[model samples]
Target: MKDKILIAGGYGNVGQVICSYLAEKFPGKIIAAGRNYEKADNFSKTTGGAVLPMKLDVAENHENSSLLDEVLLVVMCLDQKDTRFIEACIRRGIHYIDITASYKLLSDIEAMAGLAEQNGSTAVLSVGIAPGITNILVKHCKQRLGILEEAYINLLLGLGDEHGKAAIEWTVDNINTTFDVVENGNLQKVRSFEDGKESFFSEKLGKRMAYRFDFTDQHVLPRTLNIKTVSTRLCFDSVIFTRFFAILKKLGVLNLLKLKNFRRLFVKVFENFRLGSDIFAVAVDAIGEKEGKRAEYHCSIIGHKEGIITGKVAGLVAEKIYNGAYASGVFHIEQLFEPEEILKELEENIEIRCS
Candidate 1:
């Protein structure tokens, strides 16, 4: 029997893609587990039994030692507030991977590094677009320039793309919250979507307005990479919608989005309406000193759908971990994998450019 890989929330929008990708690669070793066993079972049938369906509610079964008996790795596609699930994985020596962008949750997971090392379990955090690819790009830039003084990550999401409920809720919840960021080597507080700047990408993406947001990359990069300053901003493909959110943030009315009813309404609207191209792009700019002279490097990747790209990244990382590429410890994606290597593997799904 092959080692089984469990994907929590395996029936979700992003998880579906992950299941298909890994099932094709590993064949009969994938288990799709979620709160809804019916949906998981139905979805498994679509995979031609390549994926096995299992019932797993993290909140309830987290401490069940037998839950992960035959599972060698667990890919978390859902958002979890408590670290108990991660603790359980570490206790059972099951390697873990999460695609969450939440700083607080990631910080808690990081706190368990010693225990993971002791148990010979590895956990990879920051495994998605902003924190995953963005962090990797920063590492690429730093390698090119020798030393990085400042870094800026610009994210452009396609308003026309279909995003999951969890993704939408995460955006709505953070729309009004304020967070700290390092600017010019000084820490400062900035409200989400409050500060704005114009960024230029490829001709297809062109120039767009990006606003400051509390992304996990901004928090983890400076400390991990020893960079003096790192900032991350977001912008939608639709300028009108981007400006609308910015105005609401300035007026202190963005908090209304936190209302469950309003958030659901917005999610529905986003799902039903298609305002722009379904292509998302991420660009990174790094300013540093190389060869005793000031220099800059820019790198970017453009992909069709955000969710699919995110799933592909997570799947790639899981494959690496299962193949014994990573050491037993908690690590961010950038710390464990090389940017060029990952981009090469994902070339079929994304276009990468650097200058």
Candidate 2:
């Protein structure tokens, strides 16, 4: 019977956390799958038999792979260059959830909605913190306002928190890049680490300047929420550290990340450096109309250990999809579930305030 949960890249940093959380509730039914069998097996042993290990690589062709024959759901913790494996999963009518923040990859998956529906499969995208919770928060703001004209998403990630190597690489690679964002109902090109905006995170973390960054939530929200303007900015918990990168960007020093060696070294530095508290924050500011008058709404969440929280969110969504029946097609987290439904599940682990 197809009753097992398969977590691709299940032995990695964030993947391990997801495996452990789901293993608690669905013991002996979670499979930690990856290309490295030894690593997968070792991590599984740490779960005390709750999480089983499987040798599975998602990059290869899945046309004849029977590894997923008994799997009912897949929680993707890794990023893929293409959607072939995802298509294979949907064709088999397996439920899928992805925590990736890649807009292009997500768009490809979304294009498969018709196929997914035809095969009776359900897929959830944008299942991580920024795109996951931030997307929902923006939706919350939209609900309060008569019409949401513009929305800004501020993300503060703690440098001291251990981030996965892939995440670190993505950050380092994008520091000197340019991406497009919707501005006034038009696509505008913007460079990363520029156009800094100050956001009030909390009492302990005061106001910090966050610069424009290509978080997928900003791209997904304009369409899903029908908002004209949406932007996502990123900063570290340490103010000095955040400024230092801005300076580097201003001087074109961050462009060195284009070199393979320099990029690897930069990733290494981030991996070894612990410069701030392990506290993460998300604040959303919305501008629109209420009762035909201009209005503003604000909401924020402060938490610790972002990677673990990401796993928890993914696990929560996975549990919902596994046990319940939803429309058989691709949908973003906000499109399928309400903001309150997600925030309530996280109230205990986070401090949430709205205005």
Candidate 3:
């Protein structure tokens, strides 16, 4: 029997993509585990039993599960409110990958670096779009500009795209919260969606008014790359929706989105609405000194179906880890893989622009 690769939340919007991709790549080695046994079973049936369904809840204690004995890796497709599941993975020496963009959860995982190293296990975080692809683009730009002084990342998401529930909830919850960011070599607090800037992504994406958003890249890049300043901004493709949110943010009405019921309602509304295209874009603006002269570099990627793109990135990372491409420790996507190589792999799925 082959080593089992368990995917938590395997029936979810993003998890289903990961499950399907891995099942095709590895064939019968994928186990779709989640809280809903019926949904998992149904999905497995749809896959012609290539993906085995199993019931596993991260909320409960997993240290004693027999399933852990047969699993080689755990791909977390859902949000974890705590670190117990990660600790359990480390204790059992299971390789892990998470697509979460939560700064606090990532920090908690980073705290387990020593334990992961000691157990000869690997954990890869920041495995999705904003933090994943954005981080890789920043690394590329930083390398292009020899002495990197500052970097800015801009992300534009299509309002019509079918986002996952967890992702929608995360955005709504953070829309009004304040977070710390590195600015001019000093830490500063900024309200999410309150501060705005204009950026040109590409001729196709055009210029967009992006707002300061609390993405994990802004927190991880400064210390990892030794950069002086970094910031991340977000905007939607719809001009009217963008301006509407900006107005709500200015009026302090965005805080109402922090409520669970309101967030759920917003997610439902967003999932049902399809006013814009399904295209999403990411751009990086880097400024530094090279040859005693100032230099700048810009890179952008435009694609459709972000959920699938994120799943493909996670699946590729998991395959590399399974093949012993990464050392035993906790790492971000950019830390373990070269941006150029990753971009090459994704060339088929996305349009890349560099200048």
Candidate 4:
């Protein structure tokens, strides 16, 4: 059976990578969907084969009765705000893969597991680098150690890389959120970047400092992995932004960044300007008693472009859905696939550098 992959944010940066990937690999079976029909149509034409143009707004009339009637798999590249979209897919017995960064959103989706099983659909969340690969690494350490005590997941983004406007918007909108943690084992109100704490990353994006930043995995991974403590941090490829943000955080002025006007100011100043290298990194530091021996697994994945990495993970998950390599229920990427299996695929060139 030809796997029909439907990408929701098909015209956006990461979605294009995912759509192009599935189109090339699966052939004559892919849908580029978004709210913008012109862009979606343009992307479909650009691909010229296997890529179909479809317009569907998840926020409005999310019922996929006619919009997503026969798609075998749906790779969501958009920020998933609600479970309606996931529920629509579940109602149709379609597999759902999301690359979103929302913990509340996943909690909402998890509430629908019974409905999902009744419909024979699986909603897989956290299918991107930070939450995606980070979860896999956690699984690996948990398996090796048999019992995990704590973990620190650090994420780094390339400020110089041309990220999608949507992604940039998401980042800035949530920038001043009541999140960010400064200490371990406790969730306190430490403004994002207020902590000058540093985490020197491994090769491919050498030595950099990371500050406490909120990503969904840090909130969900501990309970999901049965670990006592887990914290995630963030940094950029350029020291300039990191240092500046650190200061702004101290002054409590990062909240200004949440304004549209300031974001416009930022776009005008930094959009076309590549101040640093196009590199991304993820580091996992795990510690616990492994086989009754205390051990730690410190690993990282570095890449120049997230689009490439996101597309590959999306594709691999698509392949799994196509091959029925999934259990019948709602699950996160870590829950759906073992860390060893996921790491094997990543090592085999699914867009991740395992070390």
Residues 1-355, model 3: lDDT tens digits: 3288999998898889889988988889998999899999999999999999999899888877777888889999988889998899888889999999899999999999999999888999989898899999999988888888899999999887889878887888888888999988999999889678888899977889999999999999998888899999999998788989999999977777767787778878877878798889999889998788999888899999999999988888878787765688899988898997678878999999999
Give lDDT for model 3.
0.89
Per-model TM against the reference: 0.96, 0.98, 0.97, 0.90
Candidate 2 lDDT by residue in tens digits, 251-333: 98988888999888988988998878789999998999999999999988999999989999999999899989999999999
Clashing pairs in 4: none
Better of 2 and 4 by lDDT: 2
What's the residue-level lDDT of 251 in candidate 3? 92
List residue ranges in candidate 2 displaced over 4 A.
none
**Which residue runs of candidate 1 sit more than 4 Å off their true CA positions?**
none
Model 2 TM-score? 0.98
lDDT of 4 at 41: 94
C-alpha root-mean-square deviation, each candidate = 1.4, 1.0, 1.3, 2.7
Highest TM-score against the true fold, candidate? 2
Q: Write the per-residue lDDT of candidate 4 for residues 42-156, one digit (tens) a residue.
A: 8888887568989888877557367675688888888765677788788888888888877777788888888888987878888888778888877876776788888888888
